[model samples]
Target chain A: MTDENIANHLKSLKKYTPARIGVGRTGTRPLTKDFLSFRTDHAAAVDAVYGEVSSKLIEELDLFSVETCYETKDHYLKRPDKGRILSEEAKTIIKEKCTPNPQVQIVVSDGLSASAIDENILDVYPALLDSLSMYGLNIGTPFFVKGGRVACMDDIGEILAPEAFILLIGERPGLVCAHSLSAYMCYQPKKGMKESDRMVISNIHRSGTPAIEAAAHMGTLISKMLDQKKSGVGLVI
Target chain B: MYKKTTLLGITYEFHSLKEIMAKANEEKSGDELAGISAENMKERMAARAVLAETTLSDIRSYPVVAPEKDDVSKLIEENVNEEIYGVIKNWTVADLREYILNDEHLSKELLQIGTGLTSEMIAAVTKIMSNLDLIQAASKITVITHCQTKIGQKGVLASRAQPNHPSDHLAGIRASLFEALSYGIGDAVIGINPVIDTTDNIYALLNETKEVIDRFDIPTQNCVLSHISSQMRAIEKGAPADMIFQSLAGTQTGNESFGISISMLEEATSLIFEKGTAEGQNRWYFETGQGSELSADAHFDVDQLTLESRCYGLAKHFNPFIVNTVVGFIGPEYLYDSKQVIRAGLEDHFMGKIHGLPMGVDVCYTNHMSADQNDMDNLSTLLSTAGVNFVIGVPMADDCMLNYQSLSFHDIATLRNVLGVSAAPEFADWLKKQGLTISSGQLTKQAGDPSFFL
Candidate 1:
């Protein structure tokens, strides 16, 4: 085949998949352009992990600030157990500021990618509020926990003891989408709950599941969890 | 068993055999996260020193997780060759390492002696081995298993075409698979990790890959890496599946976390043997990694390296057709960076090979880890030189579904060309027929064009 025919053939194949294909090679290795493009994508993902959620966004969302036991970015990355518990100061602050035992308690955190919250929360948060109100649910005071893990909801859950809990957190960044967010919900969340008891709606981003769509969907899931009095694998969606 | 050792005028003591084993391991963030890693460099060396003097009998008697509490330990214990064990039970762990590295011993003798050792013994020796020691010992053994075609033959490097689509789009999977075949990949298997785990989705993927195989008459098998239960249900409904796949863990509790058990595996094996399309005896595919046990909170105070070795022990019971360690996919906690991932890859490959399994390495990393494509390139080249049975091939080294990077189809083609290795013999013959590869195992100019199949 001629080079032109191969190019068209590659284009046709590339149309069907999102994978990096048909990038012409130089000998056995990838060409410089394709190589650098991949490197750039990787750099964005790494930056997302290291970046911090802006305090301005926290104030704009009308949320109080708290922290997990994670002391630094490196500590949070290495010691997941530490990230699962609230700091003593955070516990006291949460107790003073947040409502106790509401129908639904919502929390936000930077689980892995701060950019996920930076890019997505403005769209997801308002839609979630509107959806929860439409569902006629009593929403509790929402707060932000810096450097928190998915299970950190348990620590917050124990202090507040809500019937249902939702933790809007950043997902581990991938090359295709660095600013992806996830919503983890549990019914009667508490300390020492099984992972199977938590449900997640992941890949919420512009190109994947749109932030507003995922936010709207979470309200429905929370309603279902309340109706069934359970969550995770046992709850029918 | 010895529990205290003095090294460089510093004395160290361990509380138990498990602690000794944990501290002897190379530095891993997962072990440290569990609060079990050695405190300093001297302590690590001291633990290795104590471990080297421990005998095979000592390791066997003090199983990491006792046989009564864990079915994995029970299975491993029951499978030991008693006669061979009697012959080598008195050998020290250091003796075992030297025996493996000895030039006089060939693959057959090494494999025979491996039957006498348990997983703990394997982990013990692995901790004491250097990176080169791991590679040199693994390169000496060749484990060949067969399904629709053979894999792991000497001088034959294979690739598993992982044509995974983010949405399980049939056309997208086929397109990536075509790209892989153009580069003479997928001699091991055409496997896809479906986004949906329902039986219907697995059935459709199985049929799609089967159609591709039949249309081209490719000497390869097809698999959808769904849960084994889903695959079993698909096969029961008459899907054309060549092998069943599952992710294994070291402890029974860990397997439970994956929703699998030995009995369930046995049932799946029987169903495949009774209904599946594979023409060979070896028909199970398993993927394992370090830190899975700990991730499930089921490591039982054992180290990740030892838990990973026990996964091989479990895979050995089934005689899997292909077994690979997704070495770096677990993330930075288990293997912190390129350095740790590289060490774990070599260690996993060596341990799996010595257990007489068709071992492969999915030389890969996730975005959260401090690694890049260069690390993958280095590890893949090293593994190919180590005579790995196969490596995973994704389009352009990026997996949209799994959200990680692995070796690409071009990378496999380059490895085969550079190392003077060919694909499994039958697939190589088929590639020659398609004019994608020449007799010299170099890719032709017509290669890397999916339109060639069209």
Candidate 2:
């Protein structure tokens, strides 16, 4: 198809989503600009997977730190089970530093993409806290988790005993958006909880759902979860 | 570590694992020639002594293989014997799917013989399906043929090539190509997976691969996989990429887990169809499997096999040249067992062929998966009978880079020997003229011979 004709059809579909549809081609290949952009996006994703969350970010957030059993990225990739729990020292540290029985506990982790944390944690973290405080919600001591997966929240929940908890972690880096983050929320979440019992708000990136907007949405959702005493499948609105 | 040694002035750079194996294979091939005498041994030993300065220790890909067959009693879950008997005697895969389609109260666990089915299930189910149905399953896959030009002569077509290297350095790529030429080698295409996903990397690698094909007179088309869009860029820059490869899942959500969706696939397919070198031009090599739906949290109460069929539904629209299922790569968390894995492979083959898409089986498994070569052998024969178009031709039933075990050259030959089939028509004449009895010949020698590296 001609580039103009392809773009004409794609122009309509492109507005509906950030998907890679309607990407016009040159003869039998992607346009030079699209190809270079794909290269750029892929580079970001690789960087995200390999990059580490900065200590400055943690210090700025004033969040204490703990780590999952995953001591390396290789271990994290192959062993999902190992990535879901706190290390022995980490468990002790979290137990010592964290608040007990708070109405809501917020946690952050560089789950699969440290670049995700680098890009949006600044806006999302503070915005979430402000939104929760505005609702007169009492929050627990927020902490950062190193080498954490989404399920690590359950371990934190078990240690701290919160009514509702949210784990702001990085989603797996992809060529689409390397900095996409997800907020996994659950009510009274404990270890051995099924995945279906957790609720997630994903695609929290600049091009997707903006960080500031998602934080406002997350606070409202957490408030509703506390009101209903439920999350995931049982929680309504 | 790249050894700073020059072979005819080409700096040999490769991972130690790849280097050691390549040099060792070169040594073993020289040692295993025709006859041996004391003088010949002494001379060879003297040469080996000189060669030891640079050559690393031999590393066989399949150093040891487990004994065939696991005890079914220990593998199958308890309390499913009654359902097993019903699947074994009354309903075939199609019948069970009919029940699943009608929303009957059947166990969602009931799947392919390898993943969830027991040895007993394999025994009972194989009797019901027609040999032709098993055979016709692959016919749709191989019937669409592409001609290859070997310096203006017809080359091997409708075959899979051994394509994987750990570091994917030039030395590793060369070693893999040599391994691909060994006995029982021809399958479909030679596709290398570049460690670095870039236009320059893929463009250089595939262009070098074409030189290897011309130099060695290899018969198949070539593909260096980075990503479809990136490959398109390489092609636009004038690289010789035979086709594009991608892993497709059923739903929009499920496909996104692989960093792509159906719409993205549509854009790629439309682009590829418009550009190709072949007169018979069937491009876009797709791979799909069950369990991705569940793994991606998109199954939505749909059975894995049904979700897999929907993946084929997506591939069928583009008229894919080859669509394979990496059935066992997903591991036990999804398929659970050898029975489930095997049954899923067959189910996918059936569905792909039914969708009028060419289907191949990556009759493969990972170490973490609850399957062995014995189980893969069973599936290979069943798929061969059911007409699976081709399989991934890895060295010694293993891919060093992909980290998965697949049908070795020996397994392919053994299957073809029993089934009375050979390579596609393009290579059949060559196989005969060379007097290359692939199925009848022995690809596996006794222990101590250096294994080929790819």
Candidate 3:
């Protein structure tokens, strides 16, 4: 290619997405730095998937803790079904300790990457609580679900009987970005609701959409979802 | 083409550019760029840029041909005739058929063009196309495998020393090639992975490689992989593109990440078919691996390993001369340790072989991977046991530019020693004649052997 052509290729504007392109290649392979960076990113991703959320974060949030059906980390990684429901003892604990029929139910889980919450929750959780309180939405007893998936919010909602449910969970980590989180919200969340029936504000982290900003947006979105009695694709932003 | 399908009760419609695209994501060959297909996209982009630049000035200057004025069949015939390559001059459809039927050593390129023949015309054709014929036509394409010295049979597992440099400087490339050649490796293609992937740089690199091969009289073809479009552009600018090289993904979405689509891939395939003449064989060289889907986020809930297997369908569709799987180059998120990396190599090879691909395992890992040379040794030995087509032969199998560790010339020698397989006959003979090999036809000297005594 000519120098002019090289300049043109370099000048092509890259999209502001966490996609691995525009990073030049050395011949057919990725450049050394790029390859090493990819490795670093990948190592973090694997660690995120396998790592655990800290109990200190849960205690700091002043939330009750419960367990999902998953018996272990390997079980959680391999089985999606187990991560979607409350354990027998955990269901009993939730029924006893948590209030029912609240306006909004806030739940947490290490869905795929614990570091997502371990790192970003301090910024997002308080901001979300402040926003919800400012909106005059009555909040239920907040709690954490260990070894949980996004669908666990439905089970929580069924038990707590909330008007709206917001599950702050870890998004599946990719090599591009690992410390990303999501808030999957649903109006009257219950068992058997399809994935599309839920709405999510994803890519919540410092580098992506700021956790505080996402939490503030989630408050408005949840309020709107409760008013419309819907919270998915049908809800217009 | 449009495909209407339901995945997980969600109905979706996608614009399918190839029949393969309609079937893609359903079973196999899903990703778009599985080879020089990336180049096809780049060329299309380049062409689009030119078209956009001239639109205001040239749009009204050109006369629009009336669709009704052209005969549909005649247009189809003309287009197909123009694309068909490797046939003798002035040969009619019948004449071409006769020529192909009469020649026992017809190039795979010529035979592939036979697929476009009309039904009535095909009926007149006597030679039936088969996979066995494709295997036999291996030496017809301009690939390294098609080098005068045949890809040695009897489970020899043709080898190539792929010395990837930080910069594809001619000297670094030559140093790697010569050192490997000194060890009797790289009877296959002397392919280089350049740091700069552009038409001019790659062309210069390829020309330098050609000079080395010509000067040393090496019995191998030179492959400079600069994406397919740039390679085609370089070739047009007088670059030696002995074999077309491209990286491919398993899913169309993954291929698109590399800036390629099925139609674009087909376009590049046809361009290579038309622009270059092979020594009678398959000319395309493909590189694929696991984790592309995961990296590109196109795995569609499938595991990276399974998705990698599906990618072979893309290589098989094109009839590639060499399909090298860079086993652990993507790093730990996909394949964490040496065990995982080794298993991935074995799985990719088996999957490629099942799809009738000429599989070559680049038993390699990235620097961040918790893998070592011993892991490559184990995996490549296992691959050799399964009769893989080839293994990469770099100086030490550690690519300076790419920052990945792979099998070295010494590793290839080890495989030969342990597995009892030899290099291509011509390369092995050359090694023996040059006193690099002992009488046992291996690189290593026996304990009591005095073939290299002072």
Candidate 4:
């Protein structure tokens, strides 16, 4: 193959995958542009993990805030179990503020990549609300949990005791999409719930699973869970 | 039996051998997270001091997890050459370290000595080793393995061209594989980690990668890394697989969490021998990491390093074609930063080599970890200099599928050139024929162009 032919073929192949192929190299090393671009994407991903969900967005979503037992980003990364339960004050506040035994309880968390919440909540939250309304589900008071993990839904679930629950949480950032979010849904979530009892729709972002589509899909899943009185592996989709 | 030591005028006393082993480890976040690491630097040094004085027999007498309780411990205990163990039964951990680093000992003598050692003994010596000590000791040993082609010979640096796609698109896998082949990579194996772990998915991936190898007439093997059961099903149904792959854990409970067991592995081995394409005696590929047992809640109160070494003991029993520690993928709770990751990578390589396995390293890091491509570059180069068997090569270090960074195809090619090494002999010859590389394994003008295959 000639040089130009190879370049065109490489360009054409790039559409088939997200892998960083076809970027020309310089003597068994990446060219400076491609190298720097990769580093930049990695930097963005790292920053996304360290970034925080802004308060303005939380207020805009009309969600009150609570915190997990983990107080700092470092602690959150080091002790995942700490992120799985509510703080003492958070537990008290949640009990005081939340509506108990609702049909659907929606929660948000900056699980691993806070930027996932920062970038995605606006589109996904509103779409989810509309979709739930379409399903005619009784929505409970929504709130946010800081420095939280996916299992923190169980803590909120214990307090609210919703018939069905959905926690829109941040996924661990990847170079391809740092702002991707995941929606984990469970039926009658409680402490000591088996992980297999929860279902998830992951990679919600502009590029992957579009926010609105994922929200709509999640809404449909919630209805199925309610219908079957189950979620996760038990639910027949 | 003595578990107390004073270093720099600070006294430290560990409650048990497990505590001593965990504290002696160079700062790892996982031990800290488990609430088992030494309380301070002086205490850590004190633990190392006590550990170095501890004898091999002492460690053997007190298995971290007893043989009756865990099959992994039983298997490791069962594999020990009784005659060889008797010879070294009284050697202190410090004596073992000096013996390994001594200039007189070469690959043959060291590997023979390794038969006497248990995984715990190996982990003990590793805890006291410096970075350079780990590198030098490992460099003296060579572990050659063969599947379709020979790998891990002296002056030969192999690379596994991991052409993984997020959705397991065959065309996309081929595209990245072409890029790897163009750089004279994939001498190790054209392995793909399929997104979907079903039999059909693994079967298609295995067939597709095999087709690429056959079409190109490349001296390489093809594998699809799904669950062992999925691979077994695919191979049983006549997928053209070169080897079976599984992620290993160090304990019975940990292995169960991965849904694998000794009997299952034995069954998979038999099936591969009957139905696999590889003609060599070695045909199983196993990957492990530092904190998988802990992640599965099955560490048995053992430190990650000790548990990691035990995985090698189990791997050695299978006589695998290749074994690699997927270093840095377990996240910050285990490794924390580049320093800990680098330390674990070196320690894993040395320990596996000492246990007589064909060891490689997936010199990689996730985004959440406090590491970057520079760390991978450093570790990969360090492992290469230590004569590591192979390093995983993704396209531009970006695995969009597995969602981590590793040594890129370009990086592997550079390591080979900079270290004055070549690919496996058979694959190097093929690279020369394809005009991708010259006789010396240096990239030709035809290199870096995946369209060469097109």
TM-scores, each model vs. reference: 0.96, 0.49, 0.47, 0.98
**Residue B262 error, candidate 2, Å:** 4.3
- On DockQ, the candidate that comes out on top is 4
For each candidate, what is the lDDT? 0.92, 0.61, 0.63, 0.92
lDDT of 4 by residue, A33-66 (tens): 9999999999999999899899999998899999
Task: Evaluate residue A20 in candidate 1 and report its C-alpha lDDT on the 0 to 100 scale.
Answer: 82
Q: How well does candidate 2 score on lDDT at residue B353?
A: 57
Provide candidate 3's TM-score on chain A.
0.88
- The positional error of residue A63 in candidate 2, measured at the CA in angstroms, is 24
lDDT tens digits by residue: candidate 2, A1-237: 454654454454333333232333232234567556644655666578668999998998898888899887755654566778999999898778877999999999998789889999998998898889888999998888888888888888888889999899998765556788999999998998988889999989888798878988889999999899988887889
When candidate 4 is compared with the true two-chain complex, its DockQ is 0.81
Tens-digit lDDT string for candidate 3 (B23-103): 222111112222211123333333222222222112212212121332222222333343443233233433543354455
Best-first order by DockQ: 4, 1, 3, 2
> For model 4, what is the error of residue B300's alpha carbon versus the real structure, in angstroms, after optimal superposition?
1.0
Model 2's interface RMSD: 20.2
Per-residue accuracy of model 1 over A27-143 as CA lDDT, tens digit each:
667788888888899999999999999999999999999999999888888888889999999999999998899999999999999999999999999999999999999999999
lDDT (Cα, tens digit) per residue for candidate 3, span A76-167: 65355678889999999999988899999998888888889898889999999999988999999989888898888888878888999989
Model 1, backbone clash pairs (residues 3+ apart or across chains), number: 0
iRMSD computed for candidate 1: 1.3
Point out the higher-scoring one by TM-score: 1 or 2: 1
* DockQ values of all predictions: 0.67, 0.01, 0.03, 0.81
The C-alpha local distance difference test score for the whole of candidate 2 amounts to 0.61
